[model samples]
Target: MIFLDGIPISKWGLQIQQEHDHPAVPELRRKAMIIPGMDGEWDFGSESGPKPFNFPLGFIEYDKNEKQRRINEFVAFLLDPYGRPREMKLSFDYEQDKYYRVKIANGFTPRRIHGFAFFDLPLIASKPRKNFMVPSDEIVMESDIPILSDLLWDTGFSDRKITSPQSFEIINNGTVVILFSFQMEGSGDNVSFSANGKTMTFKNFANKSLEITDNYVVKVNGISDLTISNGIFLELLPGTNQITVSGSNLNLTISESLTYQYV
Candidate 1:
């Protein structure tokens, strides 16, 4: 089974021959120099960039009226402004999960097959496909100002949640960067999160929650002493990341997806 953004290839009118992972190197270089006193060439250290991934997607069938055709949906979903740079995951058993931030490179020709639509697609990823086992947990806050000092691992808190200041901590065990999400109810429309000595906050609308993911707010409710400034975000590094939350007295609920890499 193959899924690009949770849209199954079988559902998207793609015929599967076999799942494949091809080796692709983004950058490879060598440094060599020769001098009169030196040998033919003084070999220097070579630089290698991170490996990327590619996928050859082939379609088996398509019908405009019979089958819920995907010729239009596939292109719209993959080519959308927000969906283009999204991280796409491909998993076999939800164990060996691979994630790739990618864009369609070439060969998305839609040809007809069996009086239906057929096509082949090739996608080039910006970085190597990442396969990692990630565990997620969630917890609800009891008080408006919850103390999460005892929290050792990443956990998710309530959504449309508490109104007041927030603070917490999490020790990331992953070797790479891990992103987190925070959903809340706002009063002043200004919000942001601070962690790991870095922060990504918003100050444009001063009376709403930082629900930028949805980019929708029916009510405005938030107030904080922290002078509204610019935007900052949290990126967890391997080890400990200290966090301090401040915003428009917003109801903040957080979900931390702990990232882990195979050693």
Candidate 2:
């Protein structure tokens, strides 16, 4: 099965035959140039470049009456409104929980032969990495402030969940470092999330939701809250990463999704 932007192409009556030059590793971008008299060229550094993907597909529908409508809808689904190329998530059933960020490359042209339609979809993966899915983890942290209790009245305030700062290990099986996002809910005067020795702290957090997006932007209740934030974004290394969530004078629940990548 083939999926583009989480939509199955087979749903449009198209069948994926074979893909040409689907790269396991992306193209290399090198910053080295040849020195005329040097025995070996001067080498600076190399990094992964954009990858191309070509999918040869065929339509299974034979009815000429419905072909035009279905083809139009299928084309519309693949292309953007203003013809601007945007990145779409592509995945296959064989590689579970993994996807590629790709955009339409070149143009889509379909040919008809014997009541069958065939086309080749060209895609470019700009990010040039496979994103692996990770499950979200949640932990509730206790506030440093103490609650008052009366012996005679015996309020149920003591039954509320009160947890302490939590420390956990996150394992990244990929070959490179991965940046992730996290969310915090409840109330607090200050909260901090730390991973791999880096910590990000938020101040004046009370009865609101806070999040660090995948792009390293901090948000509180869906608005940018960078003014009250400090420190670097947390990241996971290739192996195990130690993570800690702590808060002061507040009840907080932290949740995070740990997505890793492969070249």
Best by lDDT: 2
lDDT of 2 by residue, 146-231 (tens): 13211111111112332567677666656678775767777876567688778877786667877777777888889987876884
Q: What is the lDDT of residue 60 in candidate 1?
A: 46
Q: Name the best candidate (by TM-score).
A: 2
Q: Write the per-residue lDDT of candidate 1 for residues 21-110, one digit (tens) a residue.
A: 545345557888877887688889776544444444555443555533466666766676765633455433243344444556654666
- All candidates' lDDT scores? 0.51, 0.71
Off-target runs (Cα >4 Å) in candidate 2 are 34-37, 60-65, 81-87, 133-166, 173-175, 186-192, 245-251
Off by over 4 Å in 1: 11-19, 22-98, 108-120, 126-156, 159-167, 171-175, 179-181, 184-194, 199-207, 212-227, 245-263
User: How high is each candidate's TM-score?
Assistant: 0.46, 0.75
What's model 1's lDDT at 131? Answer: 34
Q: Candidate 2: global Cα-lDDT?
A: 0.71
Worst 10 residues of 2 by lDDT: 149-158
Q: Give the TM-score of candidate 2.
A: 0.75
